[model samples]
Target: MARTNDDVAAMLEEYADLLAITGGPDFKIRVYQKAARSIGAHVTDIAGYDTTELRQIPNVGESIARKVAGYLRSGTVPQLEELRGRIPAGVRALTRIPALGPKRAMALHQRLGVDSPESLEAAIHAGALHGLPGFGEKTEENLLHGIALLRDAGERVHLGVAMPLAEDIVTALRAVEGCHRCGYAGSLRRMKDTIGDIDIVATSNRPKVLMSAFVALSQVTEVILHGDTKTSVRTGQGLQVDLRVVPPDAWGAAMQYFTGAKAHNIRTREIAVHRKLKLSEYGLFDAVTDELIVSKTEEEVYQRLGLPWIPPTLREDIGEIEAALAGELPDLVTEEDVRGDLHTHTELTDGHASLEEMVAAAAERGYAYYGVTDHGPKLYMQQMTLDKALAQRERVRELDGTSGLRLLHGVELNIDPDGDVDWPPDVLAGFDVCVASVHSHFDLPQDRTTRRLVRAAEHPCVNIIGHPSARLIGRRPPIDADWDEVFQACARSGTALEINAFPDRLDLAAELIRRARRYGVKFAVDSDSHAVGHLANLRYGIGTAQRGWLTADDVINTWPLDRLTAFLRKKQAAGVSRP
Candidate 1:
């Protein structure tokens, strides 16, 4: 409902893509992209800033800063609008398809008058593309496949984009006088990787008072529905938000009902039915007489139903009710359990923040230890070299224990197609941590993918597998691996898998984390952060880990520094080479 960094970055990035499609200069295109990244990663919101203040964001030069200021002040940039008017929207839409860059998009529009995916597909099928330069038969097939992938990705917004907006609304409404309670629910509360919409619940004697504030808020662009009980509104960005008000006594039941997967609510209602009780948003009541039994707290509702309160993340009807019945529900990991973050970046690589700024942020979060794992050489665009990495490590050492945050000088080593990492054994051994990850070769066959990841996990130099699936939510699908075998390899190798909390990439997804935990594979809940602002993404990682049923015991970053250091040295203890 509110403007986010994602919104700003997306607008600027679209301008860049459209410029490239129009034969804009390569260097200029790169400038827009870089400014998009810097502005998106800036710790503070740029919406309130003037041109001078906006220029503080890296890569936002005089001209770019002025454009950003224009956007913030007037909600549009003239240049971007002019470009949008010139290009057919579908031409820009073509770039969203995998393997279809701006060049291909432009070619499609120019050669075949295929301005959209539908037209492009028709052109391909009508054999209109047979003799085109890059649109061969194989390319057509791949294009069709890419279109299907894009379709399946759907239009869900990333959790990163939705959470802050919802949190802002909750905070604002909670301050209204006479408001009894306020919180957001639904899948956002469940901490899903993406969100379709947001649900907020509140209790107040004056329903009109809350509804007035809800629809009147600056975020609400259009009032879709208005009623005493519920109100729905659309944001300028088209995210729908529903606000519901109930009596104070119905607060708990209302929250539980709204914060639901259909399966979970059905199961809870069935439990109530079995006990000759009734469960509804109003309260748990006597099934026959409708006498309210419990309506005040979620714990009481679950207690009356002969179950323990399940965490919102586990309310997916995935054996959570059964586990609760058996008193075997997991002590799920919480944000507080995280004592440090093991995967983060700096200006040394792709991150917008410098080493000191990132470290200061970590210290502010009261982290006991933080690993600065910048990109290594294979991510060539970063131009990271041994000399650069060493220089950063030296700075990290200088900063360690300076502000009560122990710094682990680390590198995010790219796992090559052959399962080898970026650095040689001697070089890798020098770092306090080596987070090996798959940066490319995402389309390898399942067998090769499985073997590749397993080999990386078992590598003595590799400590954590960063974003193991290498997924980008709706953008890229996870690697198809025989994860059971890989998990077994990691367990035996004492290699920890990372639960990257970078919103779009909540990698080593919940299902994989659960499966890996069965083999006793430990995990690191890390904010694969690229900015100072990104450090807060760890909460999403914690949610992801909880959904996977991880306890603090299953996560290495939750351990005290001594134990974490010992665990990091496990590969060294194994007496191994890449030696």
Candidate 2:
């Protein structure tokens, strides 16, 4: 039997509530909460551990240990099951939405039977929710608005998705007379965490021609707003897109104005002022003469001030220009640099695609090779045992020889709370690569959590650390851990850090990757794709690599199959016998 992180999280959450109800010590409740997180982040199964092993966990002791083991042995832990009966499932779901927390969910659930999104919406519509305590008109309206926003934003989308759509429009607009340069601007240009609208800025002598062309783009669902200098439309996906056109002479200034983080532009203007210049959408102007000075390109605008042109993505005022002046600008990662995808699941272990299908997808993308890693047996979902993993690997070998894409069969083996892989040493060794990840135990303290991952990285078979922090941006923060020590240990041990490209969990944020790179640690840009559509996120992963100043050489995936294989084999040879 294996326990998942969700199981442990639910259990500990129930236990903490029970402890509070029973007047248990505050620290004691904290322990269970921490244990739940640790268990959630545990790369392996918690159920595999016996009572003594569970007890040995940093936060778990005799009492909590017994509870955890009991929970693993059966579908329900006696204590938590009893509480689940009391708590409405709808209340729990409420906490899952952004901008809402458990306390708010609980209150909404208890007051108006808002057990689900539908019910909450109904309550809001009828004005029934407004009468509840702490529910004023403003709060009620805001909640309703929040719910609508969340409902509208049903799925995650990024610049990659929006860029092509925008570019296609730009291509058409470029054909119009007088069009000089056209590209996406705004958050899409800055590579912000998320975007609601696409902003396109075009420079040409014939602004009217460009603007007219934009209004007629094929993807436009509805023309929301249109004008000579600017035009906006609603795309089929409910995104608002706005386009602006300006004269060529002011193209550089116009681009700088449109490619704004507002704050970054403000700073740039301040810098211009310090240099006795006036900055605007037209160009840098002479302060005393009130005349346009710099022109031609955005690069020229920046170069006039002794700064090199900053890539649109690195335009955020995170020391980009300073680094630029010193010739130390971060070498952002690019799509062509990624050599392999380390964390892909196949039908063998809860992946939607068959092994062959997985191989074909990678081959089609021209990936040098990919690690066909799937979940190992632990939790109930497609519990792939050692025998299953080996069989999958053998099939992968046959496919690899003929598939044209290098296929390395591996498992997303779980590490138990006691810091052990789900399989025996021999079993792990039989594979080409291993990615040790924490699927459960998300609540562990900084010290214990760091130790758990360190233990996994120290394993000989493990080639890469998958989704090191397990954070889903704007949804869930990564578990609190000593990042410096963890990255340092990974660096010393020669483990590669993964940049998971799932839009929600762009784990190993660019900043972290940059820091890790300073220590000479390598990175893998993985889609952690569960489906074919997810493969496209590889570019987002590459963008992260680029923002981190990573070069193709710094990425293992960019290595040709031969070099990548050698890197993996080298790790295996250096590893000690698995305990």
| Predicted structure with the largest lDDT when compared to the true one | 1
Compute each candidate's TM-score over C-alphas. 0.73, 0.67
Query: Residues 86-170, candidate 2, lDDT per residue (tens digit)?
Result: 7766566565554566566777776777877668878888988755887788777667666775676645456556667777877
All-Cα superposition RMSD per candidate: 19.3, 13.4
How well does candidate 1 match the true structure in TM-score terms? Answer: 0.73
> Which candidate has the top score in TM-score?
1
- Candidate 1 regions with alpha-carbon error over 4 angstroms: 1-154, 577-579
Model 2 residue 104 CA deviation in Å: 30
Worst lDDT run of 10 residues, candidate 1, spans: 38-47
lDDT of each: 0.88, 0.74
Model 1: per-residue Cα lDDT over 95-125, one tens digit each = 9886899998998898878888878878877
* Model 2 worst lDDT window (10 residues): 38-47
